[model samples]
Target: MPNQSQIFNRVVSDQEVWDFNVFADGIYLITIQAKAKNWRQNFKRLFSDDDLAVQVDDYLFTELSGKKREFKGPGTWNGNELKNSSKSVIILLPLKAGAHKLRFWVDEAPMLENISVEEMNPDIKEKLVLSLSHDASAIDFIYKNIEIENLEVKYNDNTHSQKSIETKTDTDTIMITIKRPQDKKVESVIVQFKSTIEMNYKIGRIKLYQDIILSSSVNLRSQPDDESKILESLADGEQINILEEVVIGKFIAGKSYVWHKVGAHGKIGYVLSSFVEIQGQEREKIIELIKFWAQKLNIESSYVLALAGCESRYKVYATGGPASDDRLGRGIFQLTNQLKIDLNDDSKPFYSPISDLFNANQNVAAGVSYFKWLNTTKYKKSTESFKKSVVAYNAGTGNVPVVGKLNLKNYEQQTQNLVSCVLENSQKKKWGNIWWPILLFVIGFFLAAHGFVTKLNYASAQNDITIDAISNFEPDRSIRISSATSSVDGMVYFLANTSFDCGAQNCHSVLFQLDTKSGQIRKIMDDVFGAAVDLFPSPDGRYLALVALVHGGVCNSGVYYDIIDIQSLTNLAISGYHSGRYTAEYVGDNKWQNNNAFSFSLTQVNCTGTQRGTRKGEYVYNMDEAKLLMRMEQFGPENNG
Candidate 1:
C-alpha cells in the first residue's frame, strides 16, 4: 500500500531529537536501531525482567492537548549480524490536524538510530505481516496520502489481551480512547500544536495590580538583577509598596519572569514578582480602633498607636492572665484588676465597674486616664512627657526610676523604636511644646529649698538631745522621741514617746504643745508613729502638719499625715495614707505658704516589705476647711519619701 507520502529516516545515536507531526489519522510504522552490543542485558536490568529479550518502550507528550501516552512491546534482536540489529513496531496514531511529539527509548536510554512515519492506505484489506525472528531487522513500509479524518487505535499487550477503542469528530474537536493493560488504571493521550502556535500564547509582560509581600521570607536586593547586593531580608507578610516592575531578558518555557522594586520594612529593594501576593486588610480594624482612642485621649495618635502596638500588637482581646501574678490585665490596654478596684472604690468620686474593662473602649479609656494622669502629675508636662508616660505605662508608677537616672534604658529604647516606626508610617503631629522655663524654675526652687532645709535639720539635730542618746535605751521599746519644733510664739510642740505600744492593747503616739513661758506641757492627742516623723508648723503657728507612721494594731501598718490644731490638740484633717504593710515620707520640706493653706510632699508605699508600687506627690491642705485643697503633682523617685 505504498503511496506519495514522505519517508523519513536517519542514523540516530544516544540522544533525544524532536521532529515530525501528524496531520491525519492512519496506521504508521516506526523503526529503531540499537547500536549497543549488550542491549538485551541492559534492557532486562532497566525493566527488571530477566526473560525480556527484545522489549522496547516509547513515550509521547503534548502541550496543546495536555496528554501523555506510553507504548511497550517486543522487537527483533540479533547478536550475530550487527548491521541488521534493530526493532520495528506499528502504531495507530489517531490525531487531529496539529503537531504531535514522538520519543523512542530502549532500556531507559535513547536507542533509535532513526524514526520515520508513513501512512497506510485505507483501502487495504489485508493486514501487513511481520516475521517474528531474532535476526529480522527490516521493517515493512506503508504509505498513503488522504484527506484528514478522525481515527482511533486498539492494541493489546501480552499481559492483558483486552482491547477497546473510541472515536468522536466535530468541526473543531477531536477525541481518542486508549485501552491500557488491566493492571494499568488509566492512560494519558498526548497531543501537540505547532511551535508557532505555542509561542503566541507565551507570557511576555506583567502589570502591577496591588501591593504585596512574599509568601516566605526572601532576600531583598539593591537591583533587580540576581547579582545585585542584598540590602535586607524581608519577612513573610511584611508589607510592600510596589514602585515599578522589571522584566528579565530571558525566557523560561516560552515565558518571561518579572521583578519588582518595593519598599519593605522601611527599606527599598527589588524582589521576584512571582513570589508575592497583594497585601491583605487584616489589621485595618485594629489600626482604626487605635486611631479612635488616640484622638479621644488628646495625645498624639501615633504615640498611642505605637504604644498599643508595643503592648499587644493591636489585639483587642489580648490578656495578661497567665503572664501576670494576679491573673489580671485584660483587653487591649491591659487594665489590671487592682486598677479596676481603685476605679470602682466607693471612696473615690470617679468610680467605674471593673467589668467595664472588658470592653475595648472602656479599657482604652482607663489606660488613657492613667496615661494622662502620669503625664500631668509625674512628668509635669515635660517635653518628653509622652515618652515618660509610655515607660511608666509599661513598668508601672512604682517601677519607674527617678528622673536623671538612666535605668530602664533597654525598655526606653524599645519603646522609642516602636514610636519611631509608628511615626514614620503615620501623619500625626508631635505633642505641643512644653513650658520648659517654668518647669526648670520649679525644680531649681525645690533644690534650693531642699539644701536650706537640710542645713537647718543638721543644726537642729546637733543641738537637740534625742531618745537614742539615753543610756540603757532598748531598741525594741517601740517608743521614742521623734522630733521637736518650736512654734512662732515661743511654744515648743514636739513629738514624744507615749505609753501606747502598737502591738499592745492600746497603741498610738501623742503630740504635746509646750508653753515654755508658762512651763506647761499640754497633751494634744494620740498621733501616728512611723520610721521617721515630720512636723510642719503653719506660718501663724496655730496649726501643725504632722506626717508619721500609723502604728499597727487593729489597723494595718501605714503612713498618715494630718493637720492638727495646737490649742485643741485634735486632727483637723487627715490625708495621704492607705492600709496594708506600707510606709510614707515627706517628699521635701513642708511649705506653709500662708496661715490657712500649706503644701507638703507625701510619698506613699503600698506593699511594705516587698516594695511593690509607690506614689509620691505634692498636696495642698486647707487647714480651716479640714480637707485637701489639691494634689499639686507627682515628683521624685519611688520609695524616696
Candidate 2:
C-alpha cells in the first residue's frame, strides 16, 4: 500500500468535482478546511438557508456504474462552528484503484481554504502525496430552480478575463460560477445567465379553424394559476398571440379549464382558453393583412385598424343591430348592405356576394374597396375627407356636416377616439418608443412651414394696399351671401349661387362684385354651369378671379379660372393657364399676392382607370403681364408653395 496526502483550495457554488488516479486500493482520510463563521453567514444570507450542509460523494469507476459512496461534513450555521479546527474529516476503507472522483455539493457558495486527501497504509507508516490548489480573486454563483416540464436551458457566458463553470440537473436546476483571476480586483461579480422553458401541450402547432370570439371580458394574468396577479383586462374579440396551453388549477365548474399564455403589444399574460374560439389566422397575420390592404388603397393602416377595432374588434362573424333593420354590419370591417350598393350594379364585372361578408378575406377586400371609393368620390381625398368617410360609415351621408361646421355629434368623437387608440397600439407594437416622436415632428414641421408661407404671402399682398382704401370703402347693400370676402381696397366679392342641384347635368353658379364708395353692385359672371364654383378678388380691387366648372356635368366637366378686369369687366388673356386634359377643382380659397401675382390650387377630377384618385396642381399667374408664372401638374412636398 502507498501513503499519500493532497490538499485543494478554491471557492465553489452548488456543486464541483475533482478526479484523480490511485495506484492501489487502501484506506484514506479526507479533511476539508474552510472559514466557518464568514462562510456560514454569507451562505445563509445568499441562499436563505438556516444551516449550510457540505455533501461529499465518492464514485468508483464511471458515474453510470451505480457504485457510489456519500459522506456529510459538520453543518455550519450563523452562530455555530465546527467541532474540530474549522475542518471536517471522512474516512474511507477498501478504496478502489484506478480512476476515482470526488464531488462536493454545498447549500451556497463558500470559500474552501484547504482540502487534504491522505492515503495511509496500515502496513507502512508513511503517507502518499496528492495536492490541488485554486486561487480566485472573485467568484460569482447563480442558481435557478424552476418547476416546469419539457424545460430547456440556455447559458451564455459574457465574463471578461474570467472562467465559467456550469452544471445542470435533470430536475430543471442550473448552477453557474464565474471565476476571475487572482491578481485582478473587480468591483462586483455579475453572473448573467438566462433559461427558457416551453411546456408541451396536448395539441401540437396547428392552424386555428375559426375566429376566437371571447364570450365576455376576461382578466389576463401573469401566470396560469388563478392566484397570479392580473396584468390586464381583455375585451371581447381582442386579438391575442397564443403561445401555449396549460392546466394549473381547478375551474369554477369543478373541471380543469385550459389556460393560454398570450402576447400582445409587447405584453405577455395568461387567459382562460375557453373564453376564446382558438380559430382563424394568428393575430399578427390578420394585422399584416390589414396593413397590406390599407397600403394598396392609399389609406393609413392605423386608421383602418382603428375602424376595425371600433366596428368589430377584428371578429370575423361580429354582427351589429337586428336583421329586420337591414343595418346589420358583419365581419372585421363591419360592412353593411347599404355600403355595398355599388357592388350590386350590373355594369360592374364582379359583385360581392352577401354570404362572402362572413369570410375574412372577402370581407376585407370588399371593405377596403368601398372605403377607397368613398375617399375618391364621396369626399375630396384629404385627411379631413377620410374623417368624413369614417363618420359617414358610422352615421349616414345626410348627417355629415359641411366643412367648417364645429358642432360634431357623439359618434364623431367616438370615431376619433378609436383612431387614436389604434395609432397608439400600432406605435407600441412597431416602434417601441423610438420612431413615433420623430415621425410626428416631421409632420408638424411641414404643417407649420405651410402655414407660415401662406400667412407671409397674405401679408405681402396686403402691403401693397393703403389703409385709407380699406377704411373709406363700404358695401352698397346687404346681399344674401353663400360665401363672401372683402379685398384690401374695400371691394366686396361674393358667390350668389347659395344652393344648386349638384347632381344635375346643368348646374349654374353666379359671381357678384360690389363697390363700397359708389354703392354699386354688379354681376361679374353668371350661368357658370357645373358642380361647384368659388370667387376671389385682387388686393387693389382691379381684378376678380372666378374658378368655375364648365361643360355638361360634374363627372365630365372641366374647371378653369379667369382673371377679369373690374374696369372693363372682361377676361384677361393669360396664355397656358387653362385646365388641360383633366377637370380641376379649387381646394380652399385662392391667395392674391399684391396686384400682379396670385396663386391657387386645383385637383384633377376627371381621371379614369388607374388614375381615378385626385391629382393636385398648383398655379401662379401674372395678371398684369397676362402670363402664367408657374404651372405644377402634380403638386406635393417636392413643389409646395
Candidate 3:
C-alpha cells in the first residue's frame, strides 16, 4: 500500500506493482477508478439488484498486508448507449513508518483510469455498512479526527438536479449530511466526499429504512432545548423514522449534543439523542426501574411488576383504566387523579403531578407510593389485606362491602384480574422451587384435616351447650344461634337471638354461658339487643365485651357495647355517653390492654344536633370497675366499622 500519496494511471492486462514509503504511523485511504470488462456486463448490472450487481461481481483485487482482498468496480450505465462503465472504490488501510509494496490485478482486461493513495488521521475510516430510517430525507456520514472546513460532499440523484447537503463538526466527529429532494423521489444516490486529510471516498448507493424510541416517554419538542414547547410525547419502544438532524440545536452537557427530527404519531418533531437508541433495549431498563422503586417503597418487586403488567404492561406512558374517568389513570399502577389527591398532597416526595407520571422513575415512584398506602393504611384490616388492597387500588374501597369479607364483584373485573395476577405472580416469585409448594401443600393437607376434626368436636360441644342453655326455658324451636366465642377459661359465651326481629335494630338476643368441663349452661342475660357483631374477652378471661348496634336513625343511631362480668354472671349496659356536644357514639377498633382495662375507638357523631361531622377518640375502659378511665382524641376521622 502507498502510505503517503501516489497515483498510477494505466491499462492493466494482468498484475501490477507500486512501491511507496510511509513517514508517520497513521491510516491511509486508497482510491481506485476502473471499468467493467465489457459493455454487456455493465448493461446487465445497471438493471439488476444493486447488492448482487455490486457485491457478487468482483472486477478487481488488491494484495495488502500480505492478503488479497476483492473489490467491485462501479457498475453504473452512462446512458441508453451501450458502453463499458467505469466506477470508483475506496479502502482504508493502516500503515507504519516503513517501506511497503502494493499489488493489484484484474479478473479480465479492463481500463484502469487511476489509483491514488493519501494519508488520513488514525480515526478516519470507511463505513461500508449503513442503515437509515424509512422516512429519512437525509443521511449522516460521521468521521472522527476531521473538521467541517476540511470535508466536502457531492451527490448525484437521477430524479433531482440539486440537493441540500450540510457539514457539522463537534468535539469528536465531523458529520456530512446529505438532504434528498422532497418534490421528486430518488431510490438511491451516489455520494462522494473529499477531505483535506485524505483522497476522495465514494459510496456506491444510499438507501432509506426505521428505529424505535429508547426512553419511557420522549418529549418531541418544537425546538431542540430543555424548555422548548413540547410537540408530542413518544411512548417507550415506539417505532419512529428519523427525518434529519437539526442544525441549530442546543447541546446538553452530559446527555446529548445532537438533536434529530423524527416522524411519529403522524407528526414531526425534534428529540434529543439521549432519548433514542436501538430497538428492543428499553424493556429491561423499564423492568429494572420498577424493581428499584419497589425496593425504595418497601413493596415486593414481584407484586409491583405484576401490577405494572396488568395495568400498563410496564409501559411508563400508559394511561386510562377503570379508575380513570375524565382525568385518566396514569403510570404503571394506573393511579387516577382522585387517588393521587387522596394519597398525596402538594409537598416534596409526596407531590407527583399528573404530568410527571409520563416519566418512568416518577411514574413508578408514585405508583408504588399508592400501592404501599393501600396495603398498610386504607384496606389494612380487610381479610387477605394485601389482595383486597390491590382490588381497592383499582375499584375503590366503597366497592368492598365490609372489611371482614372480600366479596369482590364482577363489575370490578379489572380489580379481580389484577388481584389474581398479583397472587399468581407472588406465588411464583416466592416459591421459585416447585418442590417447596408441593411440600407445603402436603403439610397443609394434614393441617386442614386436623382443623376439620377440631371444628367437628367444637360443633358437638356447642350443640350440647345449646341444649343445656335452652333446657331452663319452655320447649321452643325458634331460638336460633347467632354468634359464639370461647374464652381462655372453659366458658363458651354465645348470643341466641330469641325475638322475631332476631339481629335487627330493635331485636333482642339471650346471652348464654356453657361450662365445657361441667357440661352445664346458664342464661347470662335475656335482653341482649341488636346483633352482637363480635365478642372480646379480657386476657385473663374475667370480663367479656360485646359490640352491638342500638336502635335509632342514621344521624342518631350508633354502635354501643355491653360489658359482662362472667364470674358474677351480671351484664352492664355501656350505652352511648354524651361527651361535650356529641350526641351519639360508635365504638370499634377494640384492643385489650390488660385483664381489667381495654381501649377502643369511639366515633362521636351528630355533634350539636347538626348530624354532619364525626370526631373520634381512643377511650380506655376499666371493665373490673365498670368505668371509663381516660380518653384521647385522635387526629383523623375513623370509620365506625
Number of clashes in every candidate structure? Answer: 5, 12, 2
Give me the candidate number with maximum lDDT.
3
Cα-based TM-score, every candidate: 0.22, 0.26, 0.27
lDDT (Cα, 0-100) at 517 in candidate 1: 43
The best-first sequence of candidates by lDDT reads 3, 2, 1
lDDT of 3 at 559: 64
- Candidate 2: misplaced stretches above 4 Å? 1-277, 322-326, 346-354, 381-383, 401-407, 410-641
lDDT tens digits by residue: candidate 3, 278-357:
22113444565566566656777777776766565454434552222436566556666676675457663445444444
Of models 1 and 3, which has the larger lDDT? Answer: 3
Candidate 2, 334-375: lDDT as tens digits:
777776675556564324444455556557766766665655
Selected candidate, larger lDDT, 2 vs 3: 3
Task: Please give the lDDT score for candidate 3.
Answer: 0.49
Clashing pairs in 1: 12-113, 68-188, 509-527, 529-549, 530-549
In Å, residue 424's CA in model 1 sits off its true spot by 57
RMSD of 1: 33.3
